[model samples]
Target: MTLAATIAPQLPYLRRYARALAGNQGGGDAYVVAMLEALVEDPRLFDGDCDSRIATYRAFSRVWNAMTTAYDAARDLEAPHHRLDKITPLPRQAFLLTAVEGFSPDQAAQVLECAPAAFSKLVETAGREIGAQVPADALIIEDEPLIAMDLEHLVAGLGHKVVGNPRTRSEAVDMAHALRPGLVLADMHLADGSSGLDAVNDILKSFDIPVVFITAHPELLLTGQRPEPTFLIAKPFDEDMVRAVISQALFFRTGEPAPAA
Candidate 1:
């Protein structure tokens, strides 16, 4: 089946799952829309010999899992937060179908290729694991529109909120003053020639928000004395590293030990 043919019927379920995960109405809707587009481009994952409803649910689960992983990595690189292990073999299809997508346990078990009793246990365990992670509020500052949007998606996935996207150093500073965001993810380069360092200075002058600098120019490190608690992530990074960074930054700010350097 074509991607659209596979996913169009699942849109409502996907939206419900996204909203449940996001905890915010607007953000959940946006996230589902993005995931649907991604599904259309990669439909094979969702198209299979299984019954159509089961196949659709499996595909939706996969798309959400991929997006979460990608977004988590991006966020970690930008700001270090707590390090929780990856979700294990919880039968993604069963978990989604039984829990979030509202499939009956017997039906979900069939999709997961497992027994109904086992599927129920898996769903409960996975749900508990997800509920354990506490999402932090984040501030994202990037000049690029697409990158900013991706970052927003990632932040929301982590159960965090994106306070604002300030393209310029001055605007970032102003946002920091106004929002007092828990963490800041900033590109080293801003809208003007001014570097993120300018905004960093302003934030530090007024508050103690932690920062993770995203820069394409790693060589910029050679220019001057670097700040303590220095968190620097090179651009074009995979989402895993980003998640690690964000988890580390948040943990450190919360008086936890810094993630291993």
Candidate 2:
């Protein structure tokens, strides 16, 4: 396959990482576009040893680090600063690469040009930093008792109080209206044959809050056809992924200090 073809499928996923890391879609896509341009200028630099997807990310990391260093020189390329960036540089990247993108420690370390042990520390430190932040009230909208309970546990573990777990669209809307949660986790399908999307839309009208959709239909939602969730967790998620997205969503939504990259 041609280099572009090989990189094409991974581009969307890479863009997702960029959006998360940069803290906004536009800024992230700008960096992503620049990385693609850089890669086109010299495709040979794409590391052949690692997985192609990982190699592309490694290259993007280099570009991002460079752009960050010379941000003032390229003012148009600067990304929005958020509190999450304050946790330090490599950890957030490492955390997202592994937790959000499902890259192994070895691969994520390669992306950051760091050692595996160092990468592990980066992920751990970021977790602690995020966990230490002030918790907020949360809601869960899932038809399955198990999933709703699981989300409730996760939300509580993060020091947030769970306002309620609703099983249907009406329940979700009703709970959201009454409770006004700061965070919400919704499922794409509910028990009562109602769309989770509609439920979220109704709740959004009532109040603006950070929402994470844990769905089995990730491809349908992430196809770029609809407004994407700021933070998304696919079905069969790990705790680390949940933790990372939750931290990111809350961090980006609030008026907190996001350190210079």
Tens-digit per-residue lDDT, 42-130, candidate 1: 65666577777777656555665556443332222222212223334443334444434556566666655577567756654443343
lDDT values, one for every candidate = 0.61, 0.75
Cα lDDT of model 2 by residue, 1-261, tens digit: 787887888999999988777766777898889988998898876887778888889888988888865232223323324445555667778767866787866777888888867775676667556656646778888888987888777766666778788989999998887777788898999998998889998988866777899998887678887788877778888665676677667655754322121
Q: Which candidate's lDDT is highest?
A: 2
lDDT of 1 at 43: 57
Which candidate leads the pack in TM-score? 2
lDDT of 2: 0.75
Clashes of each: 24, 1
Model 1 RMSD to the real structure?
16.2
- Model 1 ranges with Cα > 4 A deviation: 1-134, 222-224, 254-261
Measured on C-alpha atoms, candidate 1 has an lDDT of 0.61
List of clashing residue pairs for candidate 2: 82-258
